[model samples]
Target: MHLRIIALALTAVLTSCAGVQVHRVTDRNQPGIRYWRPAPYLALVETRTENAVACEVRPLMLPDKTEEYAITINAGLGSVKATPTLTDGWNLVSLNAEADSKTSENLTALATLLKTGAEIKARGVTKPPTQPVPTCRGVFRVDYDAAGNFKGFSRISL
Candidate 1:
């Protein structure tokens, strides 16, 4: 009975978002009693800068999969939705960033660092806002220039 109410509430929330489409991604990679959906995209943006490529990630996935949530990004030039993936070990998931010969290492480092931070936060070394309820959070949007250079990132929270 409780599960049904939760499912109904989630459906109602997801049904209310705009633009971005939502799809179910099951873990054919893993098996057993579990499941997860990242979040809905509220908006996306694409912009450029000299030293860093910044994507203003808006609302993003809650670390705890059981809650209803969404993610967004602000790219001045605009943005596109990418295929989603299971964000390893975190128990949350993420969207893939465009691959680039120009900035892959930097982007990869940024991503890795952030993921480490999230993991640490979840572990309670640093009391994060989500600390009260440690969750699997993923950074929402990634930035790539016209040349496909990944520059920076922003993770989703709540």
Candidate 2:
């Protein structure tokens, strides 16, 4: 029995769950951290037991404007949390958007940030209500830049 329990524990440690997908957009015409889904990225998790699901994507912004955007998404069993922040990376063009900087100013925000044919990265997914270790159903990601500046964020619950 002891050996079986140990083996199970080892298996769980070695196994990892699939995470949500985040996409990037390149249309300069679009304003702000663009979050567009051409092909639907289906979330396989649940919204009840796995009540927390989110995904965030970092845009391929200009080297100078890269630092201006950020994204952060969080979720849990019962409820979820979100926040957005902007840095100096924003340029004159973003001034108008930044003035209201809704995402940056809003302490709690939930918004997708991306489009198609982009490098999709598996960010994070958290599952709360676990006895000991809080496991997540989907993914949660904080969109950041090369200089470590935040652009946006997301949380997905399947």
Candidate 2 lands at a TM-score of 0.17
After TM-score superposition, the amount by which residue 96's alpha carbon in candidate 1 deviates from its true location, in angstroms, is 1.2
Candidate 1, residue 137: the lDDT equals: 35
The alpha-carbon lDDT assigned to residue 9 of candidate 1 equals 86
Kindly list the per-residue Cα lDDT of model 1 for residues 1-158, writing each as its tens digit.
99999999877654333222222334344322232433223223445698875543344343445432222222222333334344543333444433322333334434663564354344331111221112233444433368744444444464
- The per-model lDDT (C-alpha) reads 0.38, 0.30
Q: Candidate 2: where is the Cα deviation over 4 Å?
A: 1-22, 29-80, 89-158
Please report the candidate that would top lDDT against the real structure: 1
Q: What TM-score, over all chains together, does every model reach?
A: 0.19, 0.17
What's the alpha carbon RMSD for model 1? Answer: 22.1
Report how far off residue 20 is in candidate 2 (Å).
Answer: 8.7
Q: In terms of TM-score, how similar is model 1 to the real structure?
A: 0.19
Cα lDDT tens digits for candidate 2, 54-84? 4322222223223233232222112222222
